[model samples]
Target: MNHAQIRAFHAVASEGSFTKAADVLNVTQPTLSGQVAALEEIYGVKLFERRGRGIEITEIGRRLHAVTLRQFAVELEAEQVLLSARGLMSGQLRVAADAPYHVVPLLATFSRLYPGINFSMSFGNSQQVLQGLFERKSDVVVMPNIHEDRRLHAAPLKREPLIVFVDRNHPWAARRSISITELPHHRIILREKGSVTRKIFETALESAGVKLTDILEIGSREAVREAVASGLGIGVVFESEFGNDTRLHGLTVRDVQLEGLEYVACLKDQKNSPVIRAFFDQIQSSTATNLS
Candidate 1:
């Protein structure tokens, strides 16, 4: 196996750009591209399709990336093991989350406590973020823990209720709560499918026999908020994530309870890793200090 070629391919695959991959690997773009091209040439397979000013991984490339994810993860573990002897001082961890509100606080706490440690975060819907965890793209993830899975070491972080909101001048602005029955009257803006908040909201609507007539589906929280703020429609989100947006007014879905359990989780196999364990412990310690 050509380790250098595989590393080059993995960098490009993960970073999604030749420029980014080269910068991360500290190599010239030509050198990195040559390494990947050589790998394909020697293997007699097409790995990436050149798009205009970009590239797309082929089916075989994705399959190979899956294998490389595990291969490099073990390599990272080995490196972490060697570095642990230096008092767990220097390390990098990748973190993903379905939403930023819950995980961002934990990250802030972790950063304050472990100044030497470096971390990166990416956000997506619940499904996308969890996929990143399982695919080894992230060492840990923060997301809703609604499903049971033995493959993860999940620590419950918080339970926050979902709320609906609208532009400040909307008819419901003065109200503190809304019923599922009342939602269908105005256009309802929601996160795209796979969002925990949207899932809970939709499930409740289904149970309540509330079928929304006018719907505007958006792909992210900030976008949905902006859509609502622009008077396009009503938007639903976690109470904690509502923030202090003066352009909007938040109203609880008081008729039926809608909440999500935030959890900081790592693969069960990786819970014992030094940085992952430290993160888990830090959250527990932070929770304890808060309760005390």
Candidate 2:
């Protein structure tokens, strides 16, 4: 099938509604339907089944969609390669990041350095970022906790200490330090599962046999900070990630001494393109400066 037909099939399958897909493709519903129909006829398999106003993608359609997404990525990369060969500096960099604290700074630096390169960035929980890396959806990932995988390469970026954050009016606000055993009585705010900070806190708590009494699960670090500031719960996060706000107070960043509890940079099989290598070097140099 033609690329347009393949794209139409992918869009329809992804949107799960002909009308929605047409809107996304900026084409009429009839045209989108015709393209999808043509693709199905060529493949000799029904791609989707009607389900109310929406549609359910068939197994064959699911497979095709996955391949087409990768094919599209490869085609884009090929174009970039051609441009580079013509002495033009251009490429797209896709990165999956778990936390805004780490991502925002790095992206700011990269943007200043490589204004010509386009970037596609996604924010997700640590698990989602890792999955994106495995699926080849992202060229690189920044995550807190990393799992061992043979197909991946990882580098430690920094080691940050975890701290207890409390509302300014809370009794703990005046305290210099609090024991880990005292944590269970306070309402604790935590990031969602797959967060490096959450995993580290959970593992430490488990090891100390201290189960939290009240827990609030939040998706964003900013949300967690706000919740803690509003006295909903005390939050556990990296000290470096905490913004300077008057409403929030923090205790000493100690008690749970974690090793390698920092943002880790990961890539698949070290497939270091020139852009990727340059970005990596820039980050490394920045990290060195920060440490010094």
C-alpha RMSD values across all candidates:
6.5, 6.3
Error of 1 at 205 (Å): 1.2
Residue-wise C-alpha lDDT for candidate 1, range 1-292, written one tens digit per residue: 8999999998888767888789777899999999999999999999899999999999999999888878877876886678777867888889998877778888898898888999999999999998777666799998885477866788877777888899999988888887888988889998888888889888889888889999999988889989999999999888888999999999888788787777788876577688998899888855544333
Please give, for residues 11-81, the per-residue lDDT of candidate 2 as tens digits. 77655678877876789999999998998888789999977776889888889888976776576577557
In model 2, where do residues sit more than 4 Å from their true spots? 1-88, 258-260, 264-266, 287-292
Error of 1 at 250 (Å): 0.7
lDDT of each: 0.85, 0.76
TM-score, every prediction: 0.70, 0.66
How does candidate 2 score on lDDT? 0.76
lDDT of 1 at 13: 83
Q: List the pairs of residues colliding in candidate 2.
A: none
Instruction: Give the local distance difference test score of model 1.
Output: 0.85
